[model samples]
Target: MDLYITEKPSVAEALAKYFNSTGANFKKEKNCYKDTKKNIFITWAVGHLLYQNPPEAYNPEWKNWKLDTLPMIPTIFKKTPYAAKKEQYKAVISLIKDATTIINVGDPDREGQVLIDELLPANKKVKRLLLNALDETSIRKALDDIKDNKAFSGLYAAGDCRSEIDWLLGMNLTRFFSLKAREGGYTTVMSVGRVKAPTLALIVNREAEITGFKTQKYYNIFAHLKINGVTVKASFVGDRITAKSEAEKIVTASKSSELKVTDVFKKSNKQEIKELYSLDTLQIDADKYFGLSADDTLKTIQKLYESKYLSYPRSDCKYLPTSQFTDSPNLIIAFNEAQLLDVKIPLPNLRPPVFNDAKVSAHHAIVPTGKIPDLSTLSKNEKDLYLLVLKKYASIFFPVYEYESHKVILTNGKYDFTFTTKITVNSGWTALYKNMPVSDDAEHEQDNEVEISTAVKAGTAYRVETFELKDAETKPPRRYTEGSLIKAMNNIKGDTKESNNILSKIKGIGTPATRATIIKELIAGEQLSKKGKTLIPTEKGKNLIAILPEIITKADYTANMEILLDQLEAGKIPKQKIITEVTDFLNTIIKQKDSLKIVNKDFPCPTCRKGFLMIKYYKDPDTNTVIEYAKCNNAECNQITPAKNNKPKIITCPVCKKGFMISKKNSKTKNIFYACSCYPDCKTVLSEDDFNKKRG
Candidate 1:
């Protein structure tokens, strides 16, 4: 019997439907679909059914976090059943045991390779099917190219090492710093991560910069030259001038001397279509244009991909393979038939840069699979994102954006000024994106005021007609928006020409597949606060960074670690090589147990997600005894529950399975009663005695 293991249930359905199309009969069961005639079974694992075991699972002594057990190093990581998804694990395992041959239908990535490989028993016949898209054509293509599972051992090793290292460092470092913080008279427990720490640091450091920044006044000297009866305002770019007196000197000097056009340069340039969407780039664009959170944007991408409106939403590669050109004509025809664009697109015989250079990864870039869903049924955001990807793909067929850039260098022997302008030869590929939410073109922003006439002859003499001094204040760095933050995460090295030349080889902090998740995790752990569209670190987040070692906070350090992960994936180095490097680096920070520090922030209320814990001292003057307990800041949820296992005690409503049972005082009797957190909605109430009895 043959078994097919897919990544998720939706994929199994797609596969089952494809086989059914060929007149293969299938009987849908509880956990799997079976085609008895062909002796084929299709099953799925819900994301993942097994997770890495906790520290206590390895050693009992490592369970309790203390300074003595500062670094609980584990030589080998183990995987145990995730309690919530154990049934699926058992189902997959049971099927694997029964089958003679197993086909691994995981996503085409390192993580996906490891996910299915970990489930199979040794010596079983396993073939790999790298499924990029669920569309009929793609599924058929992937099915035809099945290879042996062992061919991806390095990819699996890289993925395993990534998880093990994360568990080792995340668990150990979080314990070490949290223990140190406990000694500092704080009840705060720091939740640290390998990627989360550096991401939080970015926010905290940016906030500090903004808070401490001081505005500085600066002066600009302008030399307006009159030539050919046209007056052109040119800023003096002779030399660095900060002082008002110095700017005055340049204005005076240029006023007394005749200015001549020393050089006139004109160059034609093309703004090619922006590259196709990588998952990270798509998230960035979605956030920039629609204020969608990274997590939400990713969900939308998945929805579109699963619906067959997109190819693969989690791709890291920007380039596509030449074979993807087979569907372009149909996709263009679909676009024109749907009336998506004003100008009807011809046959997509045009093979553009998307297929050129071909830096393809596990899958090609996210492109349409020549399928368009019913537009009216889609939500506004979904419709917007779907079209965004569709238009980006369509842009490749448009003409190259052509423009002429003109530069005029005016000099008075001692000082100089410059003017520049652009003449749009053709709108080209960008014509499709007019009034679109795409970012301003970099070349367009680099140019100055563009009213100058490029037809003027060079070396023409002109009088320095007028001089003006403009005052400006230097601006501080802006806060990181969700989009801008993702952009920064993609390139840890600065974006300037200077930094590009210096740090061009440096990799990003995280992969396109993991960057959004990192941001989402940081926000969920309360290390990052979202205000409007900007990201700000909370007080607790700031203190966590302060307590962390300088090496952990540096983006370049994390970026370099990514490069090592890549090297490990390529089988260039042993897994232990990267593990030892990370462990050694972690040990140095762990040794700083004595020096670490963090300020205590108000702890969240145990019951309600929105409230915080506040202490109230009830004093009896005669005995000098005070009844002290933390009260919730929220008036609605006034549950004064004791702490259990370091987290707030949760006494849930037995009837509705809502949140913790908040207490209410009976006005007549002065007795307490309990009600569900969803009180008005769920009118299940109980007396204090009844609640205590039920708890017991």
Candidate 2:
């Protein structure tokens, strides 16, 4: 009797139906699918079957973050039994005890491998069935080729190494920073983590660029050209054009010159539709076009996958595996019949994207379950996300859009100017994306030599209807859209030298299954905010990085750690060594705290003009207490203040001879108060009129 264990019930349910296990009796609490025929029991674990606990679990004082207990290193890490859904874990346990041979069916990724590795019953006959798609065909195929769990020993090691490294680096550094901040009298929650710090660092850097940006003015020459009575506006070239006098002279000469055909050159180019929708690509498109947050996009995609309307939503590859290609056609037909196209642009074609097994590493790119969704049944967001998937699916079978590209050159006084244009020949896959506006393409159609109607020679002069000097400004870096940030995270080349090492070895920023969660964590932590789909770093996030260690803030550092972890999982390296090395590295960063100096320009201490006000504590919104406090840098000054207990207090002139006392909330309703510390001495109370008084 054989038993299959998946990661989630959603997947198990889908797989059970495909297997047509008529005698299988389903149980939710025990999370088992008992098949009477084969006498097999299948169960699943929701995410991690076990997790790492704090060092204090073994040594009590270590649980509480204390500076004296710096570099709390744990040898021979212990795992605790933890299940977010306890009932599911119970069912899994029950199934595990009864199964003869267990087949693991987690996501075919590094993390997934670790998830299953920790859950199998001790000393049991366990086989790994790595299948990316939960479809009946893929599952049945995986069952036929089930591999020994020993084959993934290296992968399991890597996952273990990654967790340990994060623990060593994150827990130690976060504690070190917190203590350093406390000693310095700044009460901010100084934190650092392998991925969290680097990710936070990205947002912080972006914020700095935006805040410090300086705009510069530039000039350019624009002209309207009339060729065969059709008008086209010329794109801006550099102002001054090196030969401004020549340009002006030519403009004067062209005002009265007869229009003539100039030399025309043409070349054909094909606009290939993007490779099928990788989870990253799909999330990106949804963010750009539909303004969906990366997290939201993943959630929506997951629902679609669970509904059997799409394949796995956590895949990184956009190409289908050669093995899965056999089932692609039927999936396409199912999608069409399901009318998934009812809400989106009509399907361009039903063919699957090109299958390149080399590119299909862990999982094939996201595609339809071949079951089109019922538009009326889905929410607005589900519909929008479905549309994106539908279009991507259709694009694979559609022919590439073909265009005739043209380059026209004009010369005046030995100064030559060139214009490029593309004339659409066939809509092809672009038909699905055509209704969308040309967001960044600024040149007008009339200015382009689209399907040039005139056969103009290069030497022939053309009349310029009008000319003007256009003013322009050097633009600062645009704020990060969820689409762009995801790209940055996935950047292989990396934006900084330190990050390059990590980028070189790592395939992408983070795994597809975890990327969305990382983004959500940042948002939840208030390190970033979503102004629509644009992720902007908040002040708190910026301050955190400004005072964090260089090692933790470097994205490449995180990437390098990830690679090492991967190596560990692959059995290329020992987990203990990686953990030890990381733990030591973090301790070194802590020892160099004198180098990091945090400055607050406006946050000044109320007691002393020389001291800056520092945030001391963090309290839950619903329950407020004296959670934390920051102190002034000057120890002699001894400037310290307690955080407001819940909501701020409003009192009448305790000291004020006139006027009233008042308190106000910040943009997010945090807290602020205005009162005289000289309550008994000066008795000066705060006044609404005085508050309303403008300050520069």
Per-residue lDDT tens digits for candidate 1, residues 211-240, read 999988888777776655566777787545
lDDT of 2 by residue, 130-206 (tens): 77665556667777888998888788778767777777776787787767665544444555666777777777787
lDDT (Cα) of model 1: 0.76
lDDT for each of the candidates? Answer: 0.76, 0.67
RMSD of 1: 10.7
Superposed Cα deviation of residue 320, candidate 2 (Å): 1.9
Residue 189 local lDDT, model 1: 60
lDDT for model 2, please. 0.67
Give the 10-residue window scoring lowest on summed lDDT in candidate 2.
643-652
User: What's the lDDT for residue 360 in model 2?
Assistant: 67
Per-prediction TM-score: 0.75, 0.82
